[model samples]
Target: MFETMALMPQNFSLPDAIWRLLISTGLLLLAIVILRTLTARFIRRHVTSSELRGRLLMNFRNGFLLLGLLGLALIWGDQIRSLALSIVAIAVAFVVATKELILCVSGAILKSGAGSFNLGDRIQVKDFRGDVIDQTLLATTVLEVGPGKTSHQRTGRMIVIPNALFLSEPVINESFTDHWDFHVFTVPFKREDDWHTAQKALLAAANRHCKPYLESVRTYMTKVGVSRGLEVPSVDPRVTIQVPVASEIHLTVRLPAKPRQRSYIEQAILSEVFADTDYSTEKP
Candidate 1:
């Protein structure tokens, strides 16, 4: 029987080809499942870092898919050369179609490995400023915070930003180190007003409101300075006067503040300054 079959024609009918294709597909799926189970078990046993595990799992998935394709090609026999060419063409097409998506994914991987920012960090990218709520391979989701007239309050909007933007634009991670951030606001006064009293009052308000952050900010700044060789400026509340207009005096108050509490601190300072009869008195 074996000799007779070998001597017979090599041509296969449509039904036979279809049946073989189905059988190959089923075997490929079973192999994929088994390989995935073994790979996962090995990775779980060996991989300690969560990030590394995720990366390894992704690589395993890709490898398994390639292996499955190769197995199918082998099972199909005579179509091996055409199968390889088709695989290359498919891969090229996929890359071309998902170029930006691939870049975004790469950016996410780089960002994660570099530890640039993490979930719950308040970051500003271009015109968007919000707390990062979610991170995926292609995009980062941020809970939208105030942009106009709202300060740090959430605006009930979710912004999905492509991770690729991290490679292209600078990210201002306000919550990168801690909950403290440098806050600065300008207060305008009439030139004839008691500018000196106003300045002292503003400084006092800043000190009062920002006292809690002083020690932590100093420690953080000191570490940053020592490690980066950057100057560790004073964390004490500072007041600088600017005369942008002839008849007006601008007092810029710089202090450490929790990003979310900036607006409240500013309000408190303004109220304190305004309520002071000494500073509010005209220069008559």
Candidate 2:
């Protein structure tokens, strides 16, 4: 009779403790649910902007859930330390296993915030030059430009580069602020050819071809020079003579062009130079 009476207290206490834990957990969960619902409704009704509403809801939901979890942990305080240690171990293992994935995601975040490049911008990374078509946390998709072709024409190929490359490789954003690039071509002629006439002809051709963009190019270059500390060169077409070989004279023409139109402009200037009879005639 004594033994039975002594054991009854322990048995009753165990059940009482369990019941208290269950009740507390249920109340906490209920409170969390009510809080979530109320906050979500408040956000939806009061927040006008979709972006702001989404941000508020997400923050409130996470905060409320964290508080609920903390309350549950307090109720089961004895197991909290072990649970935390287990979570830390699992997190460390996951990070170690997915280090590359983490780096790629980090790179994506950096890219978005840094404004290194954007969709529809032409960028060159290492040997790959293309227009950005798609971007994700893991990779950036580009419509491939010239590889074997001489021009910056699309090659009809798509390339998916891991976002992690942005962290390690140099990225050249051709369309960063100014979409213009310099296009230069060298025309070879006989040593006895009239160099001055050739230079005049090349300059005229370039000016005629690039006249429409002269004002815009000048404004863009001025802004770039002020911001980036780069020397603002004249937007006017320039010709330089090079005599790399004794037997031939080379006339080089430099003009401002969009990256995609470099080849086209070069071809146009060459056609004009060939058509100029005065420049084409050899001096005896």
Candidate 3:
């Protein structure tokens, strides 16, 4: 205990700042009281009307109060400035310490406010594509959808992505519609192997596979277009031709299919088309 006492300051007293503040406060209060008393006395003596005297006294007291505030502010200006700087530094430190947490909360707010995705919606943020299983302020739990976008089936993996990712990455909601939506798949063929016949075969496969939900998809697309005031694309089983290279032709097929059955529908269409058409060209 003696050693601890020895370690303490030998001649401890209040710092100069505290002493200065106390002295200044006492002096200001005293000055205000004395000035107010003198003003009241002078007003009462000079003013004949009681109302004028009261008004003058009140005005004088108010002036003194204002002056007292101004004087105190001037006296403690340095300390107040130091305190403001300290507060700002502490705020900056706090923000830096919780940067990621702040971002996550902000992302959650953005997602909710903008209606980015629902709990069951299939969403892709950056490379992470899955159905949202759960969501919270800091993270989102997803049932992993696929190894790639082509596969709609889950891979039996759960991904916990930080909500902060939503702020930085673009979110792709693949299953915006309730059930059936238009899905796109590509079927590639050699340019020399009867491209016309291959295109016809791919269209036939798409039409055949997608016939059940075609009308429903079209209706939904029309409803969505009317609600959003925008022109939605055709939901018909249409085929678009793309030639990325001189030797190859790609038949891009768009058709109606459920989100969960995208891969199966695509596979079935491609299987039927491939079995029906042969695109083998022997290079000389």
Candidate 4:
């Protein structure tokens, strides 16, 4: 007991040090539970704005929890500081062991400050493209989709992207405006499938989603241009049905991208097309 106590994390008894470590961990967890309870009950109930609530929750809940753990580690493993040089050496070794984690976290921190695009923004990093689902200090997640501007199907796969990608790769954000357009087409080979009719219908559908965005974007652009000296495009929302490949008719829709819900617009167009053709349909 004497020797063991002398060799404890803080040069205290191993048993006692472990007990305190466990206690500290437990308290930290308890603090989180209580913080969440209060945030949901008091903060959320009183603060209704989602953005404000999120900021507050992140500040108090996450910040305090981390602080509590740090404090406890200091207490329970207080003696570790005696070996500060050793600790640095071990940390360097661990960094080598988890190099990817270090790089990812560093990249994430850099991107986090840039406001990391937004939740509804569409960003492409490396070869992957999708809507931004979530962001953290280590990675960005995206809901996978087909290539090009149009998404034909939901990949149903959640992609965790390393934040480091943002530094070196190009990121594109679509739907910066309220107006967005989408298109879908019926296969040409389907029986009695009127490709022309499908094209017309798809165009009409694209226009429905496009007109509002176009008008709003135009209005917004005129206002911004006068004040901020920005140039806006004169293109109207449009859809074109073309046979991209021999097997499939590609209905390409051009419209201002909506802030987030590009996938919804695509699915809605596909759903409408299915009502007429029902060829190779998938749920949105």
Candidate 5:
């Protein structure tokens, strides 16, 4: 008898299971609606206060809705679980297929949220430094800025960097000044050279070139300090001495100049200082 029963096919069918769930859900909803309607009518007839009756009806409806939802969830639990599993599988496939594109979009979002830089702003990312010419969700277009960092000259080549790089790398915004800002350069001299005289000569050249913008830069820096709630360092031209290696001494010179004229000002100061001060021991 057990073998005969086993040989008979079991009556489980997907269509039947779905139909059963649908029917149970429909019946449960019908029961709740009928109960709510009958109870609401009873409350309206028995309750004298309109506001209290209205509140009771609302509470009953909300309570019945909750019960209906719970009953439906119970009726559909197995199918809902299967549907959720399928959805999860689809989501995993979608993510795997579009990983890079997703990262690029996410990077674009990060850039917008951080407000890191804008068009015409000079920015450096890892080894790439350039002026941002265009931006999109997938990539950023930049006009290359350097044969070297201090060159401040464009290479006339456009580089399209994947926005995804912004996620992993830090962006350096070099265009910190709107009108005026500090510019720094280095002049290397022999350790045996007249260091004091060299310092005086570089300072003189810097002061001569930077004198006109001193007051304006100071005013701008003062406003920046006030807005940022910090004391800004002096914008006046200054030179500091650094001995990095045994053979050479470096004089670090800082001066205030417009952002667009940093290279020009630096070259001018360097030319003048070199002309006036001789670092070489040999007579030229």
Candidate 6:
């Protein structure tokens, strides 16, 4: 339909310009369709570094397509004198369509390169922390790894968090500072309970698996903290128990660990308590 608008020269015929505009528009659409499908397929099939690169490329391609469309828009402008204005209008469209994406990509690169969260780290990016499975420019994807694991597991769903969180929001990398964060589970016992004995058994289990790693982590934590002028973070194992609830006392243990290992350690300690605790005593 567009003729004079498609050409730089006024002498161009209406039919010739229309043909050129349609031809260019057709090619643009074809590229868009092909690139969308191919890139989606590649990202789906890959993981880790390779997948990250592919998604990053896909984000760049989106910007490129916006430029291509602007090219066509200019080619079909109503008046040759309005060429600069058409270009400016198209530039705004490019920003509107791609600004957020560009921000996300920028944040993703900063975070990934800084080693913010490695695969399997328990990180809550904008409140979606679990075990990180894959991180890409567009999203930080994780498999929820807790009591919620089984419930969400049936659906085989992965949590996809926008990477822009690295820029604007606080990231709670549970794996970075604490390998483990614990919740207390309490079953009531008599006031005359051997709580110390019960607590020991739980601590013993944790010490067995968690103690050896302490020697190495202690030095690392201390050196890193001191260099950064941070308090030499306590590396010794810790256990806190409280009897705030009637008939039950709650015990909690926390240890430094890799993010991926939190669930396993929790299960281990719980199994130890279930096996060793005596039921006759009632907590008051």
Which candidate should be chosen as best, given TM-score against the real structure?
A: 3
How well does model 5 score by local distance difference test? 0.89
Off by over 4 Å in 6: 1-84, 109-115, 148-156, 177-197, 208-213, 242-249, 258-260, 279-284
TM-score of each: 0.60, 0.56, 0.83, 0.46, 0.82, 0.52
Q: How many times do residue backbones clash in model 6?
A: 7
**Against the true structure, whose lDDT is highest?**
5
- Sort by TM-score, top down from the best: 3, 5, 1, 2, 6, 4
State in Å the error of residue 195, model 2. 7.9
What TM-score does structure 2 among the candidates reach? 0.56
Q: List the residue pairs that clash in candidate 5.
A: none
Scored against the true structure, residue 206 in model 5 reaches a CA lDDT of 91
Which digits, one per residue and each the tens of the lDDT, describe model 4 over residues 1-284? 99987776784345866787778778777876786787667877899899998888778777777777677666657566667868899999998999887788878876767655777566677678877789887889888866554454557888889887777777766534434322233334333345566667767876786666667666765675677666755556565666656666665566555545555776776588667664433435
The residue-level lDDT of candidate 2 at 90 comes to 100
RMSD of each: 15.3, 14.1, 4.0, 20.6, 7.2, 19.5
Which residues of candidate 3, in runs, are more than 4 Å off?
1-12, 37-62, 275-277, 282-284
Report the lDDT tens digits of candidate 1 across residue range 161-269.
9999888888878774565678788888888888898899889888888787689888887897798888888889999999999999999999887767777888888
Kindly give the number of clashing pairs for every candidate.
Answer: 0, 0, 0, 2, 0, 7
Q: Write the per-residue lDDT of candidate 5 for residues 1-284, one digit (tens) a residue.
A: 99988987798456878888888988998899899989999999999999999999999999999999899888888889999999999999999999999999999999999999989888999889999999999999999988877678889999998999999999999888678877888888888877778899889989999887789889999999999888888998999999899998999999898878988988887788777557677675
Q: 170-267, model 2: which lDDT tens digit per residue?
A: 88887645577777777888887777887888899899999999888888889888998988888788999899999889988888988678878898
Superposed model 4: Cα runs more than 4 Å off: 1-98, 113-116, 127-130, 143-149, 152-157, 175-198, 208-214, 221-230, 240-251, 257-284
Candidate 4, position 15, lDDT = 83
Q: The CA-based lDDT of model 1 is what?
A: 0.85
Point out the worst 10-residue segment of candidate 3 by lDDT.
275-284
Candidate 2's C-alpha runs over 4 A off are 1-89, 148-150, 178-181, 185-201, 223-231, 241-252, 274-284
